[model samples]
Target: MVIPKMAQMVRCRIGYFTLKCSNRVVPRVFLPLKYQRLCFHTSWLLNVRGKEVLMPSLSPTMEAGTIVKWLKKEGEKIEPGDAIADIQTDKAVITMEYDDEGILAKIIIQEGAKDIKVGQLIALTVEPDEDWKSVELPSSTSIPSAASVSVSSESTESATPPPGQQNLAMPALSPTMTSGTIVKWLKKEGDEIEPGDAIADIQTDKAVMTFEIDDEGVLAKIISSEGSQVEVGQLIAIIVEKGMDWKNIVLPTTTAPVKSSAPAPSVSKPAATAAPAGLKPPSSGQVYGLAVKRLLEEYGLSSGQIKGTGRVNRLLKSDVLSYIQTNNVQKVKLEAVSPKTTKADAASRISAAAGKPSSYEDIPVSNIRAVIAKRLGESKSTIPHSYSTIDVKLDKLIDIRKKLKVENIKVSVNDFITKAVAHALLECPDINTLYQNGQIIRIPRVDISIAVATPTGLITPIVFDTVSKSLPEISETIKELAYKAKEGKLKPQEFQGGTFTISNLGMFGIKEFSAIINPPQTAILAVGSGREELDSSISPITRMTVTLSYDRRAISEDMAADFLAVLRAMLEEPTFLAVKRARNFMNQVE
Candidate 1:
């Protein structure tokens, strides 16, 4: 805790001080001045706070975040690059680092706080000249604004989702995922699950994928039922370690974990002899658990259809689930759902935003789609984009594909194109780079982000180390990645980063078109439909058109042209790849 008391030179360089905590992230609350984030680097975000430190936008899609825990205590000395706290963003718990010399004076948002808006004051810091104890919330902050009041009101809708209660929050399976739906819970409440066991099938913005447990525990409670949509970082279930008294676990509440005001009063446990009620039920009449009630309503079933298995006719969630499974029941119509959430409510909200009843024609923009639109719109507007086109002769590549198909090594032309791009990148390393924070970084390995369009929006899943993979391997990898992308099952690692991007509209019959560059990456290659043309010898030649979109600041036109030239030659003479694969195989045999 070093505190220098020099008022004259008390430099406030805290924009970079991050408390090195378990969860730290350079949030995106940085000001997007002049379409800047679309340029490169979202970490060093500087927002319009003037001089006040505010809640950071932890991720690109994160509008608000929960304060998971503070790593530094109030009055603690903070150094540059010191992590101060762990913040629960839209994705996960990321550490927040500060880079200024200051003392953490006060934490405006306490631990266990949720829905802390971006730009909201989370803490107060003071330079060496100031007394840490005397620091207070500034007058100009939005704490008194109507937006802040509305945000404060929303918290009363329900208790803050309990953290450290071993509650399983919705994990961000993919980096871009904001929310997910529980497709199914593999294990019911009271069932013990091991670290590797498939606990739940979560349907993310990307796909329905298994969420495996990472700790040995008994799933004591399932908060979100099947088909229940929840935002990422929102709790869905509760787990307790083996031998723990999970049965006595207090139901989550606002007052369970009290703060500086008073010690939390112990919540008296429900009686074991009589019927035990779970989370507040939807209604008073004979309802079971909240999820159980939702399932019952979803299937339009009455209590008479299923028998309660718990003590004193208390219906366990498993009982309702079992009944639905046994009967193969279908969900009731949406209109049959609670009338409180009616079309009129939705229309009024839409009308307020549009100044007219626009609900009839408007389709709600999903979070994933909104992110895509924002990033893409900014990329085109800010970057100094340059484009170059080339026609690659693919006769030999097509012949190689046919030969491989006969040998049961089926592959696509796109696979060969991807392989050629990888090899071309190897020879033209100048073009195999990314532009970040005004610096161009050359990546050693080729990680190709293949653009795959899903029903929701476009996603790019990476084929890492693409240069080292065989054509068949690349084909299979792309196929699997595409499938996962379409199903919304792509993991963060599969789609997070890449050295270059490739978008193919060849199959869509587009003769030629340019693609927008995926920011931070140097360039993107757009492949168009293949066509037949007469050669100089009056012989037919099959050629495919490819347009390269690159950041002119990072890659020169000459470099882009050289890369395309190498790619064209490699495809025209496809034996280089085949020979390379054969040599590698022979070396293994030896």
Candidate 2:
């Protein structure tokens, strides 16, 4: 058949048939005959002399990303699988790779630029011999800017406000929350709700927080779906005033409401299109990406051999680097390396010629462990830490615990120690200060962080206003906090912003171990188990060693010593604690 002028045609011959295409590009053309199973492949390769490295979609819901760092600079010769840059998505910082081997000709976006949209040109790569200066970039109409993408993403819903309706928009739960996921809706449609009612539970970037309402109304309609991510200031639900015609009022079809500063009533629209299937995680035993697979092959390793630390146990480039550094393995030809060369074998071989397989397994660092490593590294490298240890007689505190137990009130030695530390902080306010922004901030209330060990890692839960709370109150609070912490349910406010931290390894029978100072806080006290010793009067005495790690920038050695001395006296003489309690009791009675 003849082709139209608007259509482009190409003809190819195979055996006795002629295959023709009108306008569409076909991969393989077939004939309608007895030999219909026979097909001919087409040679229609588009000329791709250069390629634009667009901002990649790192996560399923990642509309835009921030350039954390550039791994390859301009004029660098990059291979097909080389990492070009690191993109900071909503979930994590992932390395972006170059698909074609070329010379990085231009860097269009600088580092630290936020909200760069996917498919926006971030860099240009050209053949080694091609002059990139004459390359014509795509027009702005073809590829929208990052700002346009951001605006489009923000205004996915309708902008107009519904008549006479109250919109309950998603609030910025935390200072860092730009978007939040709806965990669950506490109040459903047609439910009568009053002021101070918790409408929903929102999972922000930091923690899950309750969304409370301040207006009295009937929950008319739910806008956003549960588990749907909604931007801050976007309408999530609608409420009607109590006196309005509740049953007869016709609700508008759900249209996603645009983000607004005020409570602009609007309907919800259909959710955004789901991300492509390529964004889904790989199946079990499969490598994460081409770059990761190449790196594994370069080192003659299998995907199952290296531990993955990425989300859902996906192996990342960082995990490979960590493995290489930890094992100190040299990259060799894949054919030269033995197939049975495990991580332990590599470590043992690096340490000594006699390959006594290293008795260690490579454990991928968890998210909490990685954060701990980074924060502790920063603290140790930047802050000047000075430690001092003091041994105090714990006989009085032990006797007090025994007496309290007999009164049907259970108390531990650590309880008295925490009380003593709080009292000493009150006496010496200088120790209760934080070195921040070139100033020593003296906290009015003594908020103490108690280190609790969980299965994942060590977490410190804070007890606020410790100086004012009674010993029993403090003991009960610590128990509650510890339980929540071990269950991984402690809120951000509970674990963050402490004036002091106490790490008691006494239960583990550890003796006098100094701890790294938790940042923003000047000092941390390390407590050891009590030991029995003979006193000068030949009587048995119980003593414990306490080591204080202080930031020299915030407090001097003399100040830290004086604070420890006061703490020692408070624990040694139980009378001070008794007198303080009696005075408070008498005031209450009066």
Candidate 3:
């Protein structure tokens, strides 16, 4: 497929694969002729000549990217985790890091090279022993054309850069983001913005992301106002080169509509081939996945029915919902589940349920809240979530907590649950894994991410090395993390990266509820409140419900059940925690 407006020449080896749709070419490492499913990867395959620095996917939505600048020139020695170049992704200009020690043999794509497809041969790296100067570019044997590939729209075209003016179109801040709400404009009209200067905080489907200016310019015009939901690539602001007249400049018109502007009466065309009701396809290219194709078939939506808002017209899951709302299309499952409804109808239902006014208030979704929604939806959709629940007698645990309270060593029930989970994971290591790039990584340390509810949304702050910390230490750490999460004072390391996650709604009196598994991690434990009940002895016994949601690909049913059983044993018998801690301490002493 010919990728339009992409001046960069993408060269790939014979065994490599390249998937192109709507001017978006995504390079793959599959054997020739392999098709059906697509998954994103960061590294390129290696050949006898050397490794190709295939353009790394900087963001989840990025199928293609631009090489903003190469930090290491050709022939420069690169260590593992070296930032080689800055890549312009759909989200931001992220520095691309190399993971292996090598000599930068040849640079295929240079700085300012735009629309370079992800996984395409951007550069070739040679081992330190090899001659970097003699290394040549990878073979330009273009990936053989796919026989049955979905094509990008023929009517789609790129907007040429007008003179020296920069059209600051709304970017896809997250993989699922089609349109973003301008939360606040950091750089106003007549303000000068340098490259990487924060321009505005954009409320994407995933989060409120700060959009940074990629080029130096004066804010000539701000088209989309604050709180306006602008679709990806829709002009929100205009930037002209440093000394341009910001006050008198006229705004340029584009095909993309300002979505959050005044709601006008929209009409769907009778012609099946006509464009989507009021949406514009975004970016320069697109990537269609298997799930999206299946959804299209399920919804009976043609390409023309819904405009994509992903990397260069890449269709997103949210786009399907947008189409359903736009056309008032009746869904197959919802017919039996509920009546067909529009936004107004849904709002009225909510109001009636809450005993509120007929007109409900529209709460602007913050970036953080969007993150939770997108993650929950994507986790439920992409991952085959399997569940295993265990009901553990909490009499022993409750007695221990009460006894500790008398000694001034008070610990919450969640602390005990968290500690018990750590012990259980250490025993059944198989369940403590992460599914990434189609690989199951069994993490050694037990870093548990505790889901904490804050004003913005539920944020998980990780408690690293939970297995090594004492119960008091664990309680202290959790309290600190929860406080930090609520205050928005969590550092990157404090919140990011974990092997397991625990979400407790026990405090809210929720008896039982399954939580969506966090990505990368294999499983999450949802803890419910403990309740007193008779357990065959005509005596009151406290029992707590805990459910484990796991990725079927990484964890089996047996694995999940065994993990829960171990967890139940540890929680039901409080001595197990002390014994496990002692054993660990003894091992360390040895």
Candidate 4:
């Protein structure tokens, strides 16, 4: 006998029966002569029904994703490598591919559905011959337990009711924060929270920062415990609407806390572990690991003397180096104890005899300041710098600027200087090269970095292809970039990598100053304020002193001098700035 088709039937067992009493077939006893078991696996039953396509974890730290767009529509044929949708994770928007070849039966979550948890049903796929209407979708409750469905750790932790539930996830504080450690919770469970309230202090890879809540609600539950390292976008707490009864709200079962990509030491544990035989751990307060400890020992440094920037005030290699650098500490070789001293000791003795400060306040460095310190320090120490100064008569340029102002075409002296410098770089290509890896890299394009001072620190936003942009265009671009720089909205590409740098202190009434070369660029020009002076003929002229600080490795003194001479000539002529069009200016410069 044939059995009726049942979709739920997973397995079937066949047995043989023999009857002995019945005369019709002479079957007396029922016995199992042979047995056959039919096993139906989900992978083998692919052609029979549609499979639910769950949201995939595109990134290691991605807990939920926003559907940016759908590439394929319902009933569309999909191949294994076809892109089905674009998912926006915490870090970036990435394309999602269809791993199984089938027809796109349905899209459960439409485009722009944000914060959709991983392993949640996103779409459905059915075999080409299978009827899409007849396919049954697994219930939301049973979706996680489906044979083909596998829940991610993030999904398991965030499987809460759709409405009236909000997840407070660990945010990506910076571009590099893969995970963050909970420093401390400001508000406990059942506390009413307002927008912009500091919920917790999180220690990221860079620094410890306060995590603020953007929504006004009651923090109903804290999912991740204090001191736990949680991945970016991982659920850290639960927040309910302000009027809702938080205690009555059913919380999802909390999963194990997500581990950070970076190994964070537990605060309660001992900072230093037992060293190998014949090696002793440093007597510092807390040294992070063997590498740091080894470096400290090698440098004959004490961890306590260096500020700890890692989690739980642990010493990091970078912190050690920064401390050593800031303190001007040097590694001294100890020989047999004799009263004989070296040059360094003599220098130290002279410095001690000169003066000794009783005390001073130690200020913690900001992120931008620290970066500036490190880069400037490195540039000053490594690069052999040479300076060239020229006092150019800027009376013509000043008159041109005044005439432009009358025409409502506002252009600053710096804009004219930038244009002239771009032209000068075209004429003197040797000054446009970069010295990197002991090789002179010829940069074909003239991308000039204009220094903008922000509240945090100094940043240089690049004016790309400066040789091709007109003065007014450069002026507008500089204004926009300066605004963005002050607001800290400048992207990495906007502020990084340039063939040359220009820093103008003219607005602050500064006369002449040398600027440190922003490597790997060959040179930087420092512009001072234009001061009125009388020539030998008693004619009034505005004179501005410009200093060129160049990397001696990439550019010779003569090459730098020629570039500045051309720049001064162009500025002094000032008619070159009249040609507002780049092509006309190029022709004029040539």
Clashes of each: 34, 6, 8, 6
For model 2, the superposed segments whose C-alpha errors exceed 4 Å read 1-158, 164-170, 175-182, 189-192, 203-208, 216-381, 452-464, 480-497, 532-541, 580-590
Write candidate 4's Cα lDDT for 1-590 as tens digits.
22234333332222333323333453233223232223222323322346889889986455677676688988888988999997877445679998778888778775535567788888888877665554445445222221121122232334656577686677655443446678799999999999889999786543456777766999898878888767565577888998898876666654444442222223333233223223434466663543355455544566656667654455555565555455444442354223478776676667778896323346755456666788899999999999999999987777777667766778888899999999999999999887866888887889899999987688888999998998899999999999887766665447656889999999999999999998778799999999989999999888999999999988888898899889989998868666764332333332
Candidate 3 at residue 284, lDDT?
A: 31
**Relative to the true structure, how large is the alpha-carbon lDDT of every model?**
0.70, 0.68, 0.69, 0.70
> Pairing residues by index, what is the TM-score of model 1?
0.55
Give RMSD to native, each candidate. Answer: 17.7, 22.5, 13.1, 13.9
Model 2 residue 448 lDDT score: 92
Alpha-carbon error at 326 in model 3, in Å? 24
lDDT of 2 at 284: 48
Q: Write the per-residue lDDT of candidate 1 for residues 415-521, one digit (tens) a residue.
A: 98899899999999998887766788888889899999888888889999998899889999999999998877776557767889999999999999999988878
* Candidate maximizing lDDT: 4
In model 3, how many backbone clashes occur? 8
Name the best candidate (by TM-score).
3
Lowest summed lDDT window (length 10), candidate 2: 269-278
* 325 Cα displacement, candidate 4 (Å): 34
Candidate 1 yields a Cα-based lDDT of 0.70
Expressed as tens digits, the lDDT of each residue in 1-590 for candidate 2 is 22345243323334233334565543454434454223222223221234678888875445677665688877788898899997776445679987788788777776545667778788878786555554434435234332322221222234454565666666644333456778799988898888899889886654456777766889887878797767655567778888775554444333443322222113233212211222323334843653456555554455555677644455665565566555544444444555467776677677677655566668955445656677889999988999999999987667666666665667678888888899999999999987766778887889899999876678788888888887778889999999887765676667756789999999999988999998778999999999999999999998899999999999999999999999999998865564443443332221
**Total residue pair clashes for candidate 1:** 34
